[model samples]
Target: MLSKRVVSCFDVRDGKLVKSVKFVNTKEIGEVVGRARQYYEDGLDELVMYDITASSDHRDIMLETVEAVASEIFIPFSVGGGIRSVEDATDLRWAGAEKINVNTAAVDRPELISEISHAVGAQSTILSIDVLRVPGGPLPSGFEIVTHGGRTHTGIDAIEWAREGERRGAGEIVVNSIDADGTCDGYDVELTRTVVDAVGIPVIASGGAGKPEHLYDVLTEGGADAALVASMVHYGEYTVSELKQYLHERGVKVRMHY
Candidate 1:
């Protein structure tokens, strides 16, 4: 297995880094560029910048913020939110992002995933899946795939969509649990495992990461290649370096700077 990576995420809104629980009640945390630079210098394997409110607000990602953050970071960077077409992904790549993450757009049109992947290579395309358990009783015949920043449900099975994404050429998939997001109760292991088993490509588990031990659990127990973290780091609860050290001590192979 590849060494587990510490991936840092910066949820941006109106050009500033923000943090929230379950994608609501956002609070501005820091400057996007500053946070990106700090994480890069701290030896994070990759950086993800998400415009959390763009889709819900119907606005494009802030190009200036993307340019600013991209200029400061050297590692692979992904920018997502409100990207609905091949043109949008191209523009983000031109602005210096290494990859483009699509959530609402991909769910709306699965064909776009293949088109974008063909246009920019699969390595530059990432499909971000936002999932939640069907309330009450047994899960329905299909897994629930939510969209529009988790405000709307697509009624599509996430597992089927992930498999379709791989068939269409998505290089990577990010499984984000809406219920577990910002809650930090540890990742929804069952949910992540389901997606990972269904897809052939790499899967980055997002949401519900509150502690270093959680990272260890996701990598070893949950079968995630990498984990996306937001709240803990955004609120200064822990640093990426510290998290890597903790993971390393727990027998998980994580990239460390110190």
Candidate 2:
């Protein structure tokens, strides 16, 4: 098996790193650059910074904040939110973002995925889907896509969206369960596995990662290429190195050399 990744996520609002429960009740945690540097120093494999209010508020992503955090972390850094065009994605790349994540805009116009892949390499385009479980919904997977930081329901079947994203040339997919986000109970392994099986590309499981066991479950049972962590690390519940060590000792392949 390939080495599994432990990614630290920064949900930034007004240039401050904040976290929320189920995409609500957001609380500011700390500065983005400082926390990012700390995580990188703690052996984080990658970092994802989302301007959480950018798309919802209809504003551009905070480039200055992105640049600040990007300058401090040597690991791969991904920036998302308010990306609507190739120029926006290219601008983020110029601002030192290693990858560009898109959600609201991509759902509104699926062709943007191809447009971005053509302008930038497919490897740099990440399709981030925020999903909510609806048991009796009009979808086979019983899951639907939510956009604008989990404010609007798109009625797009989560499983089908994953397949379509792969077809449109997204190199990776981030399946963030809105219901599981910030709860820290555990990752929605079932939701993640559904998407992973539907897509041939790499899948990253996000939301509800509370401890090393949660990460392990998602990486193994969920068949995810990586796990995105927030609350567990943000609140000092665990460090990136600690989580990696836990996984490594359990026979899960993870990067030991930071």
Candidate 3:
């Protein structure tokens, strides 16, 4: 197995960093550029930035802000939200985003995933899924896709969508749990495992990251290639290096030489 990744997430709204629980009640936490640079200097393996309200507000992504933040970091990071076409993905890439993450747009038009992936190699295209468990659903796994920033449930089985994403050329999948967002309890292991099992590409387990133990659990038992953390680092509770060191001590392979 490859070394597990410690990915930091920055949920941005109006060019500021924000955090929310269960995808609601969001509040600004910091400036996007400063925080991105801090995490990069602290040696985070990767970063994921979402323009949290772009889709819900029916607006384009914050390109200038994306460029400013991108200029501050050197590692691979994804820019998401309101990306509706290959043109948008190209713009994001030009703005310095290493990858493009599609959630609501990809759901509304599944073909967008392949279109962007075809335009800019599959490795640069990612499918970001906001998912939740719906009891008595068609999926035996019980996880369904939620869009519009988790406001609308699509009833689409997450497992199946992840499989389809891989077939359509998505190089990676980030499975974010609505039940766990900002809860900081832990990632939804079952939800992550289901997608990991169904997809051939890397699966990043997002949401509900409380501490290093949580990262370890998701990367090992949850079968995720990486764990996306926010609150634990955003609130000054821990630094990226400290978390990676903790994971390393616990026998989880992490890129620790930096």
Models 1 onward score TM values of: 0.92, 0.94, 0.94
Whole-model lDDT for model 1 versus the true structure?
0.83
List per-prediction Cα lDDT, in the order shown.
0.83, 0.88, 0.87
Off by over 4 Å in 3: 53-61
lDDT of 3: 0.87
lDDT per residue (tens digit) for residues 90-143 in model 3: 988998888999988889999999999999999999999999888886777788
CA-only RMSD, every prediction: 2.3, 2.0, 2.0
Query: Quick one: RMSD of model 2?
Result: 2.0
Q: Give me the candidate number with maximum lDDT.
A: 2
Kindly list the per-residue Cα lDDT of model 1 for residues 17-91, writing each as its tens digit. 888766777888888888888888887899988876645442444677888887887889898887888898898
Q: Give the alpha carbon lDDT tens digit for every residue of 1-258 in model 2.
A: 579999888888988999867667888999888888988888999998888774444334477787777788888988887789999899889888989998889999999999998888889999999999999867898999988557888889989998898899999999999888877899999999989888899999998988799999999999999999988888897889999999999988999987
- Candidate 2 global lDDT: 0.88
